[model samples]
Target chain A: MRISPTDVAQVMTLLHDDPEFRFLILSDLCGVDTGSVMQVVYHLWSDATPDWLRVIVDGLPREDPRAPSVTFLWNGAEWAEREAYDMFGIIFEGNRDLRRIYMPPDYQSFPLRKDFLLADDAARSPGQGVRHMEQTFQPAEYRRTPVLRQGLGSDAGHMAPGIQTAELASGEDPAR
Target chain B: MTTEQTVRSLDDPDLFVETPGTIYDAIPPLPPRTEREAEFYTMRDGEMLINLGPQHPSTHGVLRVVLKIDGERVVDLDPVLGYLHRGVEKICENGDWHHAISNCDPLEYIAAMFSEAMPVMVAEKLLDLGVPRRAEYIRVLAWELNRISSHALFVGWLALDLGGLTPILYGFIERDEIVEMLAALTGQRLLFNYLRIGGVNGDLNHDFLSRLGDWMGNALKRIEDQQKLLNSNEIFVARTRGLGVIDRDLARRTLLSGPVLRATGIPYDVRRAHPYSVYPELEFTIPTREEGDSYARYLLHLDEIKQSIHIIDQVLHRMPDGPVMAKVPRLMRVPPGRAYVSIESPRGQYSAYGMSDGSDQPFRLRIHDPSFFNLQAVGLLMPGNLVADTMAIMASVDPIMGGVDK
Candidate 1:
């Protein structure tokens, strides 16, 4: 079931209170950054349902995503919401203890956001001047040795031996 | 300037101001960032704050708890987490589907089989893959053995934390045997990345079977001996009985599963509640205790060991012969979809939610670790207990910090 951010608290309350759909256990609550939008996903388990019922609070904007907290329904949601906030920067409104759970309190950027590039990913792009070590620095001498060139070789040592030192020095990939 | 004038000038606000310390401060007096922290930091007339651990031995791992106490009794506690956080979810999203399984291995380091299994099962679901019967049986066998080892350590640690030492020695003996058997099967002892997306990595071999058969014959007897040592010990019972009681409603509300929830008499085991991975085909029982105290949780672990042994025996008897590894592409990309898979780990329900965007890598992989949620109960259970009983309560909950901080 997909719910709007505003309807999260109300819909979750209904699921918890209704005898027919008593999803008493909030099996999981997590934030997902799908590149297009931020989503708060809730997994609820109940005897009533054979499998887990997934409720996604979809279409929260990437910037300053806010969703109602379900801590009142199930207190276990507290840490889960904190983790989501810590990783994805989605504020779970009404969670009294809404602080960073896994990240340091002073962490500036949400690590799990789509836009948050990992150090290596941020350092170089596909066609940029910066190249991966394997792409640029295959040793010219190591390639000359036959036994070392074929089987027991590091990733950087596996390039074609025919490529000249000048090509390797210029960081030009003959394979590409 | 003269020495006296230099000292005075250095002390002057205009000349030199005090710099606030960073997080590394021995005792950071920084302002509280949240409501709970502010409440726990504030001291009443007779109350004082005691920092339990980011380093205490009984904390199991690097878990810090700020305890507000009035004399010997704990008024409140705020557990400060993130000491073991490795940004596992983000790392999983950055890697491909296959790498996610191995990356998850360290989440529940104690029982890594379940941690690895979660991602594999979720990826299988997303890919709509069917594992062979022999492979499923192998997976279940590995998981049950891992469960026994985890529970054995839990028994030992709980006893050790409460000041008894003998039971842990016995606990380690039993754990070592099973772990050695697993090492023969999985190639690594602790972080066994055995479960592949479609099936397990290797087939059961002669060495693994012989070791398992040898252990199986004596496993029950060994556990019974350990039980004899601690089950009726006056000191163990005195400390654990009626301590850190979590009622059924609270257990449900807190989403406690496995033995802790079972100890509360709910009997909500993931294997039976939401059956997965050939568990529905297997035979076993969900053990429960109505007392819901620390002792009940302790006894539940012993009872669970017996049940796991039973499951293993059944698996061996029903073991099928076939190729273990399924045919999967070297570079696999799952269809764009979302999948949530939960399994009954020794601690509780270890689950994973995998979202694939028709790419080799997952868009997001959320791991719902049992220890993370189980640790939350510490904050709920600690208040109103004596300061000394903190380790006792925490041990019974058995929250592995790797999982909690992940």
Candidate 2:
């Protein structure tokens, strides 16, 4: 069902009351900026059905962003709300605990916000210790180890260039 | 919202080893919180705080579950992740479109095809490019094989979790074959950076098809053999029969997808309801379970494997001869817009949310990993279960850690 911003409160209540949507799990809440302002998108799913609902609730001042938390419905929303806080600078009212999820707690600007820019010096080597991504800092000269693979009964590609039984290499039976 | 110290015992090590004597090396069971769990029982009369892992073998991938239990039952379960979170989304955000595909390989390493495709499919939608029929077929082929292999791992892992060892060996016996097949075609066994922006990075030759077809022919029998082994084992049935019983109401509310949602008897296959690639034209059945228990969920995978094999048989027969790529502008620029796309992975429904500011790289990209959403569900399934059956239920839910904590 297509819902409006005015109906966000009612929808949140329906998420709790409606047996199908109760538990009110908000799978993802991310900001999508059409141009000037970003539209807040909420992806919700049913605990019973193999289905999900995409709910779009706009929270755009691009400055003083705020949206009511659905944490009351599902406890899982606590962390999701924290991620939203760090990425979009969106304040989740009534959120049980709001801290930066991916970034350090003292971080300033939200990396996911459309206007956020990467620092200058890190341009030449994108893999360098550019701010925000520290623990996963890989240098420019890094080369991934190449993968070697082969199929059974066929020499279409490189097969490690060794003498092993065809079926044994494929992990299948030679009898087959 | 809780990082309770009560989950630990004074004698417990932060990281103690499970399966101490075995080669498998599983994590040891969490020590019972007799004194504190008793207080949690007295205070809430219903609120129970139980731990799921850091040691749990079901998905020993740094997964932990905090459950609010109400006397042999789970009132609410909140999943604790970030243990395996490498900030893959953050990594993807900085890299260009091409660079991102390589990074996507590790998101859900088990079903690397789906993980890799999740972003590529969205990029295609954003770039407004047509995927060559050959590439779509190749994707369908690789994806189905990956689906089967992942399902095999699930079946085997479930067996291992439920105290059965035979099925796992049989399942991996088949997995090694498929991994070899993928390795030959994509040049990488686990991470296939084979899918490029406009088209595939390579072609699907004769040997790949024949090898894949051989596995497809025998995988159905393997599933059949597993069913025989499990169906005959009374212990397997008893432990898994009604343990971790999931109600349809909770299943629908949580938006459970894949086999778990199917195990609850809902036909919400992304391939069926929202058919992508050649799923619409191809023939396959959507497996379902009415009981909504671990056994029904367990039986559902056996059925799903059959369906995947059936789809692969068609993919092999209708192997249309053509180029595996489409022509496109070298420098891609997606016009300002947004598109949310999903694929029914072996685990559940995996989706990607893409936005572009009329640029080559997306202005904002968010990957809604299925395991991330599905892992939250362990809270719902873990309650009312024995400390041992926790892993069994986890296997039934099938949370791939890479996907869960990505």
Candidate 3:
């Protein structure tokens, strides 16, 4: 079932405290980043009953994503909330230690965000294509010629200055 | 520039001493607001800090816990994790259904079959597909075998942590035998990517079955021998019994699962609670103990091994001969929906939550690892216990950092 960010704490209380629901365990608390919004998913399972309840708090604003913390109800939510905060930047309100769980505390970006680019991607210049092939074939002839860089060009035989390219011990073609 | 100036500079308090108005000086002191916070902030005379591993052997893996000890008794503990995080959840979201199975293999490396089974089951549920009867039986067989190996290692590791070496050696003997059997069936011993989308990758051959039967005959007796070796030992009983006790309420509140939860007198087994695959068809009982201590948890592991063996034997008896896999498309495009599938893993309830947007890849994949939850109880179990008892408590919890950090 889907609930609003405002209703998360109350519903969690009802699910946990109410005798009928009795969802004693907070199995998982994960965050999903859609293009426009963040969805904090809570999976609750009961010890006495077989019911697995999913409480999804959808439509948290993208720029400032925040959800009410359920740590007070379930201490296990502490780490799970920290993990969500670390990965998706969804702040869990009322969580005392809302620091990063998977990433370093000083880490600036949430890697799980859809728009977050990896540090490796920042190294490439505009129009600088992929460095490695997505998938390589066994045959060398079918392989695409790698784009050479300035200061390290084809004239250098793809070797940087001061580095020598050795011939194969068999004295065969380098490609072979 | 001169020798006199150099001597003067070296002696100067201004040059030698750290400045008062630096970054460290700019921070304001925190005043405790709550009664509990006040106690934590105030350091009693005997209280001192001990940082135990992101590298300690007793910690099992790369887990660091900052423990505040009041002499021999632990006053507080703060477990620091994420040393082994590899962004597994994000990787699962980016990868296709087939890739997700292989990616999740390392989460619970001790029982690779259970870890693999969770994702496959969730994907199957999301796709609304039923596995073949033969495949379900094969999955049960593999899962039970993996559980035995995992529990065997735990038995050894727990004993080793408590300063016993022979049990771990015996544990490894059983584990190696099962792993060899698994390798013959799955090709990989440690991280077996055997479970596919709708079914398993391979069928159980005659050789594998015969060997499994061979192992089964002596497996319980061997485990019993292991129990007798440790359970009756005066030191083992003294170290484990009445130490690191977790009551039934605390166990449920902390969300401890699997054998640890069962040890607290709650017979909540996911296999029985939410029956999946061929488990519902199989006949096995959930064992519970009222002791709720380290010894009870150890006994629970032995009992569980027996129960798992029973389940596997039942699978062998009702083994069906047919196609192993249900017909699945090459590119499995799971329908837009959400599903959570959990199984009774070695440590606890290992669950996989998947959300699909009608794409070949999952929109989001969340692994609700049991170790991650069970590790939380350490905070409750550590305080007021002897400093040495911390190792015993953590061992009883039996967290796999691969699953905890992931």
Best candidate per lDDT, number? 1
In model 1, which residue pairs have backbone atoms overlapping below 3 Å?
B53-B64
Candidate 1 lDDT by residue in tens digits, B1-406: 1222223455567543334344533323334445554444434466666788899999999998878789999998878899988888878887888898899999899999999887799889999998999999999999999999999999999999999898889889988998999999999999999999889999998999999989998899998988889888999999999999999999988878889999999979999999998899999999999999999999999999999999999999999998787889999989999999999999999898988899899888889898988899888998999888999999999999999998
Candidate 1's iRMSD: 24.1
Error of 1 at B311 (Å): 0.5
2 against 3, candidate with superior lDDT: 3
Candidate 3 chain A minimal-lDDT segment of 10 residues: A141-150
Residues B1-406 of candidate 3: C-alpha lDDT, one tens digit per residue: 1222123455667654322221111110222222333234334455666778888999989998878788899998777788999888877876788998899999898998888776788889988898999998998899999999999999898889889989999999999999999998989989999999888999997778777878988987998798789989999899999988888888877778999899999898888988888788888899999999999999999999999999887898898999999999998889998898889899989888888899898888888899998897888888999998899889988999999998
Clashes of each: 1, 20, 0
Off by over 4 Å in 1: A123-176, B1-19, B24-29
Better of 1 and 3 by TM-score: 1
Q: What is the lDDT of residue B386 in candidate 2?
A: 62
Off by over 4 Å in 3: A47-49, A119-176, B1-42
| All candidates in order of lDDT, best leading | 1, 3, 2
DockQ of 3: 0.12
* Ten-residue stretch with the least lDDT total in model 1 chain B: B1-10
Report the CA-based lDDT of candidate 2 relative to the real structure.
Answer: 0.68
User: Which interface RMSD values do the candidates have, in the order shown?
Assistant: 24.1, 21.1, 24.4
Residue-wise lDDT of candidate 2 within B1-406, one digit each (tens)?
Answer: 2222234464666325311221011211211112222212222333446675656666658776665566665655545456777656656666666677888888889888888886688888877788888788888888888888888888888889888888899889888899989988988889888888777889986777678768766777778888898877899988888877767667655556778878888777888766777788898889898998889988898888888888878887887888887877777676777767788888777888877677676666777667765665676577566666677788878877787667
